[model samples]
Target: MKHKTLVLSAAVGLLAPVMAGCGDSGDGSDSGSAIVVGTTDHFTATKPNPAPFDPAFAYDTGSWNVLRQTLQTLTHVPRGGGVPVPEAASHCAFSNGNLTYSCTLRAGLKFANGDTLTAADVKYSLQRVLSIHDLNGAVGLLTNIADMDTSGRDIVFHLKSPDATFPYKLATPIAGIVNPKQYAPKKLRDGFEVDGSGPYTFKAEVKDNTLVKGTFTKNPTYKGDLKVQNNKVEMRVYPDAPAMGTALDKDDIDVMLRSMTPDQIKSLTDKPRKDINLTEMPGLEIRYIGFNTSAPIGKEKAIRQAMAYVVDRDKLINQVYGTTASPLYSNIPAGITGHTNSFFNQYGAQPSLSKAAQVLQSAGIHTPVKLTMNYTTDHYGAATAKEFQVLQSQFNDSKLFDVTIKGTPWKEFRPAETSGKYAVYGMGWFPDFPDPDSYVAPFFDKDNFLGSPYNNPQIRGQLIPKSRREADRGAASDTFGQIQDIVADDVPILPLWQGKQYVAARTDITGVEWAVDSSANYSLWELGKGTTTD
Candidate 1:
């Protein structure tokens, strides 16, 4: 397949001035006027840091959340969810066999400091990201770009190979444009200062690790898709979900976004509260177990396949996750376009000791295969311990293998997993975008994100590149389906479950359902406090 030509429409002009005021209505009821949000994620800046709010360096979800509001990318995903829309760029397109991508900046655009935003800034920002090449950052996504060119108001990127999803990558926070004058070309900025053209600006008095303190104000010079509903948005950081829930009940916080445990969410369902509103959205998150294929135990395809057959996803979702998640049959979750039940079709829903035994027996493998499963105790959530324990019990009970479970904190576990210190480990994925490619491309690539020695020539060499050339994403579904089937057979990773997005807010707060953007990002712009809903 070859890319011919493509073009995008002009970007929208700057938004008009919005009315802003903060005060409680006098009826002993706080109409949706002001909002205080609670979260477990924290974002801060120190004297000496590698990436202080620099889009190129910031990789964590917390930092990206803040950048999403303060920085404008070339394209953006809509509030509810949909295809990418132009933001900073008036138009973006590809020509000459998908090797060339061109973007035209919106006319008369300027930074919050009144400095002109031009194609040169775009070129510099992208080149800087590539130059820094932070391991923790999303720089790998831009590896396809061979070179970039700049004209009067246009920037062009020449890709090493055809990539249909390249445009979708530009819509992410990692592609946020930075002012060349305010930011250094090489190193990240040191202080807690942001000079973005997004809808909001970070308040100077921001304090991290403090509850109910940090705030962001509407940027007067900003122009984008979202209009700032509240004059000031306060963010409260909590130690755990329980603390966040308590704050929500006590009116200390209007809404809670992330890090809520399944038990906490189940409690809300078990005992309904009139004063609280709970909204759930279909999520693109998937939890899976990655196997180091080069390791002694993981080297056996039959052993991996037997483990998959013996494990029960229903128990994981119902008992461990309290039904907050659904059983996932493939790497691609339900919300994504190419999601399928390939695993289920290959191996039935229930764990079958007989089928697992047959698979191992056919491979001439002995009984009671010794395997150790590694998982992070602190990173995933409080329930991760129980989840791994459940997995341990299932494997031991199957009588096919003797399973030993081990745990480590996320900080240590991440490096260990990436270094292949663990033969088999568990990990979860929160999508970079709500596309089927996001599921397969990253995990199955030659140099995959998992750090596991999983290299499938068919998937890495042919399917991915072929799919990338298909401009219509939906039409590429067959390729993704084939990829998932191949993965199920290879058994490099076992898909466990897919989680649902949940947000618990006070009844007075409107737009709870709309708070989560199409890309699964919690957008503060969609939130409001009042009886009326937009």
Candidate 2:
């Protein structure tokens, strides 16, 4: 789910005076120069990842933000949050009892390089992503599609099982259509440029295999559902929140998103800056500890359960995130349908060494179980190291665990997690879509994306399929509740906290709300440096 956890961000209503100073007429008519965006998010583009920006392999939100502006998917969730709507495909639908999905290509579609887009291109794009099956890619989401073919101007997909959420998956960059001529059929293309029929075409600058800057220019040939408000968007990469904040203060960047430290956010929220606009919105981000079930110590379910029981979510959130986040006890966060407090119901409100010990003793686990907590050094923000440090202290304080914490750079951290190098590690989820299935399937499905050998047959087999079958999402709440209960009992992943979305932008920036939509995908096209017409 890091695809979107993949990253965070600003308020328009509080910036009237700031706009006047920037030469905007309170009405939507002025135009400004290219927009520079600063973010703390990083992606792995070194060995094992040759094509960092290729949608076939780019799964994280940072990369998605770049890919989203350059590559167009068949369908996409609306900017304001809604069901999937056409992007590349003029229309798409489920038929033959939801097992078959079909889409008709938008006529006269062309890539930035002028390659005519066709149903064959869509078919080839989907096939290659599945064929490459990169650990960092979104192949897990497409595993359900048994086969697919192009008939005339239409592409048809046959699923192994009935999956109503397939359309939602298509809405993600995972299904972003690639130019067949530019991308190899089976191998990831090597380069730092994109050629797709989206709102913009991107050319990225890389130094030492890490993205330095990515510039998006409006694609004059773009034909899509979105309206391009800005002609160009320049994204600058920062090492951490403090650096990003510095850039914002120096006017080197017009908007900052994907992250700002909680303390930085608090400062802006407590004392409003006349030149800045802080946009606060309901966020679906959740952070958790994933266990490497294949490891010797991690294989012990009782040990995981004990640790879960000992985790003080309230203390963790309060000390590390303050008012920015709330304690989460279930894999599914609160606002999502079918969410339940399974862990809370099982472990109660406070941390209990007694309960933790009891579970360990019952399962014959030795006292003070040895554990090493691992986290990324930079990707998540400045708060991540502190968050895990707090966790180490809490776990050790329980007297039931002997803990050590390790921090690795994201480039190394990601591959290690997928390789099962850590017994237990920290991870965060930014749902791919607003659906609850996005929360569970990616973590517990048979082809779970986390690489932690967590395979619950009940969740993978029954609960998920049952939940997906119901066209009406609310009808599957009971099934999801059961899924959460199993997760609570197994403890494959320990829920930590859910976040509040914050975006910081200069007061003159417009469309902060719509650009960073509910799905957390940034629509660079929605951003403009003036009072945009409604």
Candidate 3:
């Protein structure tokens, strides 16, 4: 079955506004020339920098955005969206009970530095990802691969089990190939320098947690589906969304890409700025509160269920997020096949204070149940603090719980949360690839991303493996539905809301709507600044 494309809709009511003067019309001057892009996410190699240019070590969305443009993988999701297609490889297939997967590379591929990109380089790059295995990196995605081999131009992978999503996994930037001559096999390459076989090469010097101001020229060695519309692309990093917005309004940046707050999106829509254009696309990004099942407060299933029952998702969507998000009931967000409103089906739309009380009472818990909630203020957004405050009020207002909220920055909170320091904590996810299995498999597996002691044999042993084997994505919906039912019953996490994708660019800039790929990576190649007459 074909995946549904996220239809772009104009905002209604307070959200009612259209792209006033922002369309694909411009003067013939500078047409098909160059463009400059801006973002709030910092791209640097300094301490506390999440935007490491190294594909093996970087996991954040900001880093992936850059890596996607500066690297090439075996397979990639097309801009129009569908199944994964070959990028570096000419074709790929699986055999031997779906255990052995092989791909033959398109001949004469070379790195930006003029190094030959053979199948050996592909095998070495993947091996390096596993060898380094940064705790925060995406090496976990390749755990299914038992072995890798190369014969002539063909790269082969031997999996321990049949995985229908293996090709999709290869399509991600984590599986992007790096030049063996420039990178070490067992350790991550030092510094921010990159030598890749992508559409664009990494350019400019790293300074003060930012890239030096310059344009990144297109890679002549790149052999992929994407064509560089603009020969030169300039990227600038800002400290915050407001700063980025200010720069955009001042004509300092051609486009604003990442980390735009919901309020910013709403403000742009409500005011209808003629100079700026806003495009809303379907988003798979999801935010949730994870319960550390091993912790004191999390050990009790009743406490977890009560917390889920008490969260006011409507308030979160309407108040904090504005019209930028919709209430999500299951781990799998809408737009993906197998998505269901399991939480709503189990509980109701609104918070059930009485039901929460009954759940705790049945567990023989006393009144005023004490619980501490943890969140990251810097990572999620400044609004996260306010959101948590509202949650505290909701839980306390119920008259059955005493909640204490604590927050730390992402750098500190991530380690603490992973170590199970917080009884309950907030987390968000963006898909590595656009697949329903991407949602369920990563979070529910035994060695799950949550780092919380959440283990269900039926889910890990049977349901997930079964879903992975089913070739028909829609047919796998039943297994995913069963998984969501199990999740609703167990209540390891509380689904908050799913976000929508928004990109704001100047009136002269075109192709902002088509910038986002199926995996949600924003492409620099799709953006161009000039008139159609060019």
Q: Which candidate number has the best TM-score?
A: 2
Global lDDT of model 1: 0.75
lDDT of 1 by residue, 172-254 (tens): 77788888887778777754566688877775445452223457776787766565666657777776688888888788898
lDDT of 2 by residue, 53-156 (tens): 88778777777778888888999876555567888889998899889999998899988888888899898988989998886777889988899988878999
Rate residue 104 of model 1 by lDDT: 88
**lDDT of all predictions:** 0.75, 0.82, 0.78
For candidate 3, write residues 412-487 as lDDT tens digits. 7776887788988888888888788878866888546666688899999999999888777787889999999999
Q: Pick the candidate with the highest lDDT.
A: 2
Candidate 2, superposed: residue stretches over 4 Å from native = 1-32, 531-534
Models 1 onward score TM values of 0.86, 0.94, 0.92
In order of listing, the candidates' clash counts read 3, 8, 0
- Sort by TM-score, best first: what order? 2, 3, 1
